[model samples]
Target: MAEQEHVEESRKDVLIVACGGSGRRVFAESEDILEAPVVFINSNDSSTIPLVPSGMEGCHGDPELASAIAFENVGAIREAFQGYKAVVVFSIFGGGTGTGMVPVILRCARDCGCKTISVIGIPLSFESARRKLAQGALGKVSEASDRMYVLDEDSVVRMCPDARVNSTFRMISHSIIFTVKCIADLLSGPFFSTFFDKVYTFAYVSEMNPVKAVEKAITASGDDPAGGIVVAVSSDLGEAESGAIYDKVAEMTGMVPDIVRRNDREDTKMVVFFSVWGA
Candidate 1:
């Protein structure tokens, strides 16, 4: 156990890769908050038109042959991933680039000795065709990824019923960003702990009252929540409010959660990320 922990600690480099148009847009918007190296994979120059920050990188491929290219250039992709402890991939399913490249990237990351986690956004049920494609991609992702989080678009719609199209996408982006940040905090923050053997499930709630956020997070974790839950709260709330959030998480999970707080936001709204491990 000590040797395994030492191995994990030694490979601390983390790389976040975003694929497809929606994924790239999310990466571009949330890059400031991510505070890590980012690689954006796209199928064409049009998708790369957006202004990317200095430290970020981009990989472009032909739309019709992106998956093929990924498979053929496995060596190059693995090289890019070398020395990283883990690679977290953010992609929206149903799209050509993201759906096709996700599995390939997962395989490449593993080959490079990096543990892989995929954060995928599934299409809403209303979009039947897209949902079908997403379902197909899910199988490949399951086989390749060491761990996976499927963020249902229907959940985003339910959370923001009155939100416009752009607002809905923004909410999805917030979920992805918060989830990634929470995991990073556990792995490298000042309050680091070895409780995260594997993240079995996760939930995200944004712009909600602290109590309601905890309730929603628990509900999102499903009916039976038995695990060491890690709750990370990002808000500008006071110490008392933060305490309330922590207490709620502990009460709901029936376990003393590993809690982390961030007060950098100017908004009154809070973003809560919950990651549950164990059976």
Candidate 2:
């Protein structure tokens, strides 16, 4: 396969919006580390000012009636999202504000000619009503978004077997943040510059070699090898070790990947982040 080098402009027009109380909570926890500008849309006018970034806009409507209100006053929401090329929307799919407003927000983004990515959190199995609502909302989201990442609460729980409720919630939040960061890093960071239509992401920690790690991450991502792949490795591996992993990925994907390496002092295990992008 011929190596194709496609360099595009940096993703400076990216906008990250958190669409409900749960979304805002995750943003608040991760705002300090996030690299992109963020907007918070909520239903209550409580004390979110402290959680939100200064100078950024926050839209408040009625939580129970967010969908109606948003549809009625879409001009205002569209104005808020003006001047963005790509939009990343974060929300929990089961709640009233998050569920109702996500589709509206996604529609607005799409109408504005912006690429839209929705990161939606699914409710736990015990919350049957919430799960049902999430299932209903997911259809609308799928129609509205160009790409979607569904974070399953059950999968997170399985990952953290003995964790408490609060810890599980934190774990979920962290996973969302990590995903958003990885996407931003791949699109906007100085490492690589290819404009991709869809991205599939998966992360895994293993003691195996880089080829096995790539295989595991690819299987977990559930992405077909039809487009370019970007890999980020976080480990204490030396230069030669890292190069070996990169070579394995290039061999498997038949394309030169955008690679990012990080040194982890405390852990010896390699954590590989795999992102497969659609052409």
What candidate 1 gets wrong by more than 4 Å, as runs, is 1-12, 46-65, 189-201, 219-228, 234-279
**Model 2 spans > 4 angstroms off:** 1-11, 46-64, 189-279
Give the whole-model CA lDDT for all candidates, comma-separated: 0.66, 0.64
TM-score of model 1 (CA atoms): 0.72
Question: Measured by C-alpha RMSD in angstroms, how accurate is candidate 2?
Answer: 7.4
Candidate No. with top lDDT = 1
lDDT, residue 1, candidate 2: 13
- In candidate 1, how many clashes are counted? 0
In candidate 2 the C-alpha lDDT for residue 88 amounts to: 87
Compute each candidate's TM-score over C-alphas: 0.72, 0.67
